[model samples]
Target: MTQLTVFGTLTTLSPFHMAHAGVSAEIDQNGRVRKLGTGTAKLPCTPTYKVPFPLSGDLAVGFDGTVRAIAEVPCLPGTSIRGKLRRVIAKRIKRHFIATGQLLSREAYHCIQCGAFSGDGIKANLTTSAEVIAADQQLFTGIFGGGPRLFRSNLRTHDSYLYCAETEATDVLPVIPETTALIRAYQATFAHPFIRRDDLLDFLDPIAPDVIENYAEAFESWQNTVLVTQERKALDRNAALEARAAKKRGEVVEKPEASAPTEKQKKVMLKGQSALEAVMPGVNFGFRIDIRGDDAQCGLVLAGIVDMIKEENFGGKCASGYGRMAAHLRVMNERQEEFPFLDYDGRKLLVGNQIKSYDDALESGLSQLTSASFEAIYNPKTEPSPRKGKKTDDHDDDEG
Candidate 1:
């Protein structure tokens, strides 16, 4: 069980949002949906973390005469956290080469780190003549997995739940009554609702005069057809009702022919308004990461985590001032002995037990990462030529 575990609390410095691709609807007494709201992935995935409802069966009603249930709790999913870390690491590596003026070929770069962090597909037409390329491939695959040889990742991440005083520190989120109580308490606070405005139509300064005129004409056409469209809809509804009545009376009913949609119906208008849900600031999520590698491997993962933390953004909607979190990480051995991995005092990244400065640690980490093999593969003086061969017509070359 020789593993290095990094455990910490990530406090939200700004509103955090992780989109869950589903809708939550407000139910009425008759079980009919009154309204629908897009949900965020902040909800807990397991029943162990779900809030307990009282036996009284009393429920809260909304202003629109709809009943809403607050049975689930919110949490920061580890998959999203892992995805964000991987992206930052890949970006950091790319920026490092660009800053050093290496200017490696796109194919060569892809060959070096294909299927490492993001996907599990081998890039086509890569010629591995040099051992340096293979070594670099191993380095990346060993850390993140799924390179040419498909090495398993040495690091594992666990789902993170809201930090509660009663919960103990563990790699996997504990399934206990206290955890349920924590979920219950967190459900009480819930997510804050905010209206995201569509300002694209409001600002037209950059639009060309001709383009604006075209838009005006289109809008005018839509306006003129509005009354006609309403009348058509009403007529269609009446026809449908008559057809239903005729069927009920045992009379044969001929279905109407399908008509093509008109241009007015296809015209883009103002986007629909949606109330977005987001986790508020000042809430802390407990997270844990286990590394089954030596100091070098651990250091590399820590470097990426530190780089991502420096950006101070996670999950989604970061550009709109959401998902900013401040991390407080500490590394410990399997025996529970503290191992000085890295430290971030909200500004600088200090590494090792001695806590070296950010620059020094970065230099050391980069040196270990870029050894003789790496230099041989990415010689700055020699520009890598693009792979020569017939390009495949496969459009499935997505770098997932």
Candidate 2:
């Protein structure tokens, strides 16, 4: 939406180069030459200005005959836009002149920073173009709502430029559902147009439609699995608690009651028990595995056990540490599909009771353990060896 203009000798520079300078000027207005000042002793002589222009008004013409004036031009958004413009100019120059062996002046071939092009000329140009392209790809992809890292990477390297450019060139393209929703939401909230529909459709079409659909479906499926799993776990836990309470009740009965527990008596007993019982014991009481502690005391003790199993190589024929832990924990508690707590030190700490996978168990265990506990467990008693003095084979052998 921003704009700037550059005035320079057309004979001396390419139109693309002029365009690049114009874009830069728009972004950085300070680059424009404002006034004709008196030349100092070190660089003596220009005191002139006010010359007749071919069209409209008088132009500020220096003693050297170079005219300076503001030219009207449109610019891309932000610094990245300037960089891309530079890259486009550089690429065009390289392809038309440099690669074909056309002779160019030192001024024409000079690097802007060093004023020379003696080393890695082609490589430098390519690298600059690549970097700029990468940045532009990232910006455009973000504008589109979503994109893959690989696709973005390829776009930057010119590998996917044709595909992206073609999409950009199209009209009335299909859009992703998420992107469409986002556009609608944005329009509703802002009460103004921010992203053009054409741009949205262009970006969306390049990204495979099926990939987006599948990703959405997969995410929903995972959410459903988690919800169902949690429900089933709650039901099983409630049944287990009820069974334990019933057994305790049976043991407490020393003799058959003179009268069986009537409905009123059962209601009274249940109310008394409810008053004493704590709701959500899991939330009220929990343990942590301190991974950084001695014996590797962890937030979840199950993870700690898994760590032990792995270190000892003790879980039958299974080579994977995770697999071994899952197997061993399953044997200990048939109801548990995996260890709920990760091993910490020699014991397993409770992380969660319904973790269904080893990965989840490990994560839950680590989270429960506090940083202070970790420091107490794993913090070295001795000071670390100085970097300069470290030279022993034993030092090299240490994993830390």
Candidate 3:
């Protein structure tokens, strides 16, 4: 049987940051050494966290005790890609089950058989682990395999390295050492510095009360409901503890003081600054995924990949518009002569051996996954309730 492979180039639509904890110390303009990392440290203004991009290796310290920059090669590990795809696929599967309702109890059994859905698919629990294992043998689980037995996944995702202009070949992903050689000086990643200001409302306080009445009310509500409630609770607990300690010391304690917002709290709420080392928008990376499965499994996996590209953001700081990527993908069988597939840009997919629009392709895959024939392989009717067996953990290694 020919194996299916999905190969692609993923290009960043926005700046992306994946922080590595390795710290580097360098002398600032003030001639004092400052450490850079995704950790707490004192900055010129205030103590804050600094986030740095994943480096090829930690910065080296010279014999003179000065820290120097090492070659930096930004990369996206396969684990991140695989983990996210599994989650998206699982979510889609659950939604499909929900959409079908009671129209197909047999199809619902397939989900129940696989323990991945957290019992949403279970109508009645099977008596034995062996029975559960037999019932769980569905196409999705068979391909992405994770359960008590720790079955190996049929899918293998390769680490994607940063793609430079010289490495335009997306057919095969290059290794880190090779990628480092291809890196251009101008293509080195840089951090985007930003200051977060929570004091915008403070400036508005000076405006006439009538004009700012709505804003004031909204701010007051948030401050009272969230910040004040939490802070007061903490303060009250501390005060009570102090009173208890004084009583133990045989000293008279005056009435405990009401909690007041501290100076540190004011500083934290007013202003903050940090920087994230990030790859610039439009940077590309080469990725590959190989799976030992039939067309049904291939189509399902393809649908999940498309969903991740179109709807989800990768890496860190997605809330700040980082990690958005567009995929330029191609799908094919290993023995090209046996099962031919066409190259695909971001907007299309292979459905029934023909290139189809994204929506149609997605629908086609989901249909097959939700079909009766697909689920019949693990039909609950075929299995009888066996002797009760020991419970087993469903956790499986992501790397597998």
Which number leads on lDDT?
3
TM-score head-to-head 1 vs 3, winner: 1
Please give, for residues 44-139, the per-residue lDDT of candidate 1 as tens digits.
111112222222122334334555453233467777677777777777666766676556555345534444322433342243545433543444
Residue 126 in model 1: lDDT: 47
**Would you list the C-alpha lDDT of every candidate in the order shown?**
0.52, 0.25, 0.54
lDDT of 2 by residue, 227-328 (tens): 465445334433443454556667543332232334533332222211100011001001111112111111122332333333422212123221111111
Over 1-400, each residue of candidate 3 has an lDDT whose tens digit, in order, gives 3376777577777777765544443223442333432223223121112222222222234324555454234677787788778777867777886787623454444343443333332443433765444333445765675433333467898777676422333324532223233543225455454656544335544554546558768777755565555466446644664675677789787976645645654444344434555677766777788877655566667777866776647888899887877666666667653222333343454333442443454476566565453344333344434545633344344635
Superposed on all Cα atoms, the candidates' RMSDs to the truth, in angstroms, are 11.2, 37.7, 12.1
Sorted by lDDT, highest first, which candidate order results? 3, 1, 2
| Candidates, ranked, TM-score | 1, 3, 2
**TM-score to native of every candidate shown:** 0.57, 0.14, 0.54
Tell me the deviation in Å of residue 248 in model 2: 0.7
Evaluate model 3: give its TM-score: 0.54
**lDDT-superior candidate, 1 or 3:** 3
Candidate 2 regions exceeding 4 Å error are: 1-213, 251-312, 316-400
